[model samples]
Target chain A: MTRIAVSLLYAGALVVLIALPQLISVKYYLHLSILALIWLIVSQGQNLIQGYTGYVSIVGAGFMGIGAYSTTLMGMHLGLPVWLTILLAPPMTAVFALIVGYPSLRMKGHYFAIVTLAFNLVIFIVLLNFTELTQGEAGITGIPKPAGWLEALNFRDREVYYYFVLAVAVLTTGIAWAIVRSRVGQILMAIRQNEDLVGALGVAAWKYKLFAFVASAMFAGLGGALYAHYQSFINPEVFGVAQSLDAILAVIVGGSGTLAGPMIGAFIVIFLPEYLRFADSFRLIIYGLLLVLATIFMPRGIVGLAQDLGARIAGRR
Target chain B: MIEILQQIVNGIAIGGVYVLIALGLTTVFGILGIAHFAHGSVSMFGGYLTFFLVAGQGIPLVIAIPVALTAGVVLGMAIELLAYRPVRKASHINAFIVALGLTMMVEGLNLEFFGHEQVVIPTSFDRVFNIGGVTLPELRLYVILAAALLIAAMTIFVERTKTGQAIRAVAENRDAAILMGVNVRTIPLVVFAMSTALGVAAGIMVGALFAIAPGIGEGLVIKGFAVLILGGLGSIPGAIVGGIVLGITESLAAGFVSSAYKDVIAFLVMIFVLLFRPQGLLGKAS
Candidate 1:
């Protein structure tokens, strides 16, 4: 719990992550790691709104879709560099988020959740039915990788892309950390505990909620852009309500409102299915059971559970 | 004009289904203050059971339906006591999560039991009636009538029964109801039973009229919530009117506009309603 211990822990993690590609025997695991890292960015953003702000936005994957499409379409039509398209993805997604978050942020609790879910369904509908642009479920394939800029290393190589995603994940996570530790995060948390009390104290709670919502969308956008480039295949199917729910699961199962929670959760959500391949028929049932059990017994998630155990051990010692 | 009337008729049938779904949702939400997101999936479970009984086994449609309805009531009670009751004292968010988890579990169970293919309950109602201009199919007419009958019965039960009075009292104020000697413990069980029974009826209607599939329940639940928002969250009459209006809107949208974008249009209407009238059509303006 000390500063040194925390720093040492982070350093140890960074070292392990850096050496992960070399340590893994299977290239498939590397691919899964890359996916986990991208999810890490999304889960971090999800933690901002759902975990800290106490508002569950089910449109995480919808915004990610917007970002993915923005990056893909812009690159294809405008003949722009892949990096430039990826860079613009967040801002592009932010515009849509602002449009959605403006009216949506006015509601609270279940109402907010329902409205956001509708938004997600709408996004998916548009992506699927608007075939002229989104290609109608067939999806846009043969996407270009960020190859020319990194000519020294083959971007198509799983290990190289893994490292690229790791850097981006670390950077985005750092941004999330900064936001959470800042005054904005404090107000957001305040809004979560009691929005009316915050408003009674003369704070514009809606503004903070809107800010968190928009920031979280931007993170999703970033993750989606990275996902599009990494997989070189962008589809609306991958960016639907189910993926958004997975993002929420990552936040809940890992530990809401904690820095390391999403990091651990993202991997679990992505890999848990892979590990549960033996029980393919029972996968969904098991998944649902785990979510229910987690919400009931481990409401604080793994991080909170670990922290509680640590405190108890310290007390006994 | 006849085309328009036909669309309205079509919309009414589907709207009736939406009303039942929303009614089930509103009652639980009204009395217990739980969103009960799994209500749709649970309803689908009922439909699937009826399908398995009639189609897979040799049970008659009439016999299979009541059995499914009874099973639905039992499942609803189990959900309340096991999944939801444990988190009664926790934050509302925890309850919502449990609802979501229950949804996944029920959906998973449906998939496990019924496979992934869409199933439609076969019926012998193959007649059609022609009004002055518009046409009405026999099955759709039956669906509309059944829904109306259920709504009327629900209204009477809530308005005329002692237990219904207890439910409304609990919804108004739980502590006050407890103080007034209302057995608050069994009320949730009763509400879940009634709500899930209504949901089962809706599910059977859906199976008989259209088809029940893996993702259909999720979509239906979302539409139910949309109706809840449109009619005011906890208002029974609002849910009825909202369900009808939404069904009609979707029918008209599909008939007049793009069929592919009808769901999108319905959602757009919901968002617009939220913007202009946050209290809903029938909800008291707070």
Candidate 2:
């Protein structure tokens, strides 16, 4: 009953957000909100591995690239339906995650981060140099929009797509929340705290970590597929190391452990810069400074900070 | 055969730079247990400083190299004191966060000062030396020699000096070293200084050999980490061996196999290494 209520509340909140662009007249605001939504999906995926499982992956963008390319290639060359390509991209990226994660997860701490970092570099190079297939740095342009049944419904505007994206985002968030609330989530938390203890308890820690990694890659891939269709273009930069680092930064800045933390962090990471566009060359400098300040003061993230405030209020009462 | 040898020679020259970078990273990671992601950006800053000195101010290369290296030492000390020291007692994640933040800040600083265009430090050595039909650029020869000299100096410092003994002792057992009256606080500063100087040297080589740009550091750091993994994290000899292995493997793969898959091939080698020996090629079993 609680799960149903919580999911419904989330769905309602998402519906309101979906309707926001229609209510507002600002195109720039809508654009920023769309970017926030895209980042929210990626960061949420990041939170699965880094926040829940404690394996800090820096290849979120690589997975995104995998999905984007898969969808774009399938839709463009194979002439597959958009829905089918979207379905296929996540699993494809999952396979890649498994391949990369198997050897990488053997090492702990910074080793894992570095291996994932290398994965991003390798993938980006492939995307750039594979000119015959990927069109090189020029990127694949004019990717078809989400078609068939959705297009049949005559919903093609940015407003209509916003609802579609929001619905998927909410559904994925609900599913992720459910998984985190389940026994599997508890095992992940246990692994995060102490892998040896969890292994002693008969849990195959490596398998669980692999599972989290694949799942995270799946969501990132899904987000990328959605983004490719939405943007109508696919580029190699989508899989660059900087994009991967930005996703990790979003997870860190927004709050890593909590369910809503990645979402909040996604908003700050995506939208904060848009607001600070006037800062020009100083924008990244400000961001770097903000990140340092945020980490020092709110190690737990903004969601964690909010929880602390809520606890303080309750204590005062 | 000639092409293969040429590629190998090229790889060795580039591998020398990776060696210096991996040495810097390993010292900080091995001794202090911090990932130090900003090492690459700091190295790039060193490159930019060298460019500013040699190109802008018209200083001789001899004077500029030491000045840039000195700047690196000061920057590393500042990073240890300001960014890392504050979160010494906190969760490992705090340091990780700070490293990421520092990386962004330094990169941003480089962009602000250096602009986006790739900058190469002008060198007088434009001649190519060929031996047995294999050509070696004079610049690459210098890079290789300079890297060798730095490595030797670093090895001697770590092996022979009292401070090096203290550093090794701390890395082996920090609590034991503290009990032995080794000044633990000063060790991180020293480690950072040494690491930064090594990174600065790499930056100088890169500037002369290739060019310095904004995103170049990210790529170098990834390669450095690859060396760290291939050689074994925290192993000095491992870093040297691993750096050479990776550099040579990447060049050979690019030359013989496919240039497109060079990075993939290098990582595939790392993955294979991990499969057989998870501790790395020369890394002691953890």
Candidate 3:
């Protein structure tokens, strides 16, 4: 009953937020919403590895880049359907993640973070230098939007695309929540808390970390595909370290270990800059200051804070 | 043979900068168990300050570097005191988050003060020396010398001095160091100041040899961490060797193979090392 009530509240909030772009009629807000949705998906993906499994991946944007470039190239060159490209991109990203994560994930904690950070750097360089395939910094432009069966309904509109992205976002979060609540999530948390103990229990620790890493990559790829199709342009910069850090920041600030945390984190990280447009230059200072404060004061994140308040109220009762 | 030597020389010069950056990071991580992500940005800030002093303020490169290094020391101390000290005993994740935040703040501050334009310090040493057909730039030579000097100085400080012994004591066992009258709290400040000064020196080298921009620090920090991992975290000797190894590999890969694959190849090597030897090249197996 509580879960249902909580989900309903989330649905209501999501609906209100989705309706906002339409009601405000501001192109900027629409753009911001689209960005938020992109970050929402990315943050959720990051949460899978960082929050749920307790492995810090600083390369979320690299996976997103793979998805973006794969979808863009396939859609543009191979003349594949946008939808098909979206479906295929995640697997492609997963394969890359598996290869990279195989050895990289063996190193726990700070070592893992460095490895992922290296991955991000390498991926960015590849995207920038592979001129023949990636168009070298010029970026692949004029990516086609979803058409055919979906196009028959005139889903080309920004509002329509917003709804489409929100639907995927909802579905992805649902899947994520389900996974986190399942046995796999339990195993993941166990690994996070005590990998040696998990290994003693006969669970192949590396296998589970690898699984989480690939799954996280798939989510990043899915988000990247959506972003590519929505924006109709892709660049090397999209997969750079800054974007990856933003994803990690979103996961951290949103509240790790909770479903709603990444979503809220995505909202704040993506929307905060938009809202604080007047402080343009000093925006990063504010962001940095906020992150410091959040880490110190609300280490459990906003969701954790809310839960703490609720627990206090219940205790008083 | 000549080409290999040239690449080796090139790598060594670049490796010197990496060594300085990694030294700062290694000290902090080794002593405090905190990942100082902001070290790169702070280093860049030092570089930018040096550039401003040289070009904008009309100070000589020699005078500007010391000023910037001093500023770096102060900034490092300030970060430890203001940003990290309060959350020292908190969760490791707290320090991690603060590190990320401080990285952004420093990068933003650099962007604001330096503007978005890339700045390079104008040095008088524009001459290139041809040693056995391997062209070595004068500025790069100076960078190598300066880095060696700093490394030697740091080694003496850590190995010979009483304060350095205290730092080593603290790193080995914090509680015991505290009991032994090591003044554990002041150690982090000292570590940060030294580290930041080294990072500033590297930044100045980059400014003179390459350039300084907003996101460059982020890239440098990543590389520094890579060196950290490759050398074995918290090992100063490992940092030096790892930085050189990474720098040489990157240059050789870029020169021989594809520049695009330089980073990819370097990381692949690190990954391979980690798979076979998880403790890194110099790191002891826990």
For all candidates, state DockQ relative to the true structure.
0.78, 0.65, 0.78
Each model's C-alpha lDDT?
Answer: 0.92, 0.88, 0.89
Candidate 3 residue lDDT tens string, A1-317: 26787889797988897777658767878878888988898899899899989999988999999999999898778988888999999999999999889878888888988888888888998899989999988998888888846544555688878888888998899989898988999999999788999999998888888988999999999999999988888889878988898888888888997888999999888888777778899988988998898888888899889889878887898
Q: Would you estimate the TM-scores of all the predictions?
A: 0.98, 0.96, 0.96
List iRMS for all predictions.
Answer: 1.0, 1.4, 1.3
Score candidate 2 by TM-score against the native.
Answer: 0.96
Pairs in clash, predicted candidate 3: none
- Model 2 chain A lDDT-worst window of ten: A147-156
Weakest lDDT window of 10 consecutive positions for candidate 3 chain A? A147-156
| Candidates 1 and 3, the one with greater lDDT | 1
Superposition error at B103 for model 2 (Å): 1.2
lDDT of 1 by residue, A130-217 (tens): 8999898999998898865555678887888899899999999999999989999899889888888999999989888988999999
- The list of candidate 3 runs beyond 4 A from truth reads A1-5, A148-152
User: Best to worst by TM-score, what's the order?
Assistant: 1, 3, 2
lDDT of 3 by residue, B1-286 (tens): 9999999998998899999999999989989889899999999999999999989999987788888989889989999999998788876666888999999899889989989899888988989999989999988898899889999999999999999999999999999998899998889999998899899988888888888887889888888988989999999999999999999998999899988688889888888888898999999899
Model 3 native-contact share: 0.85
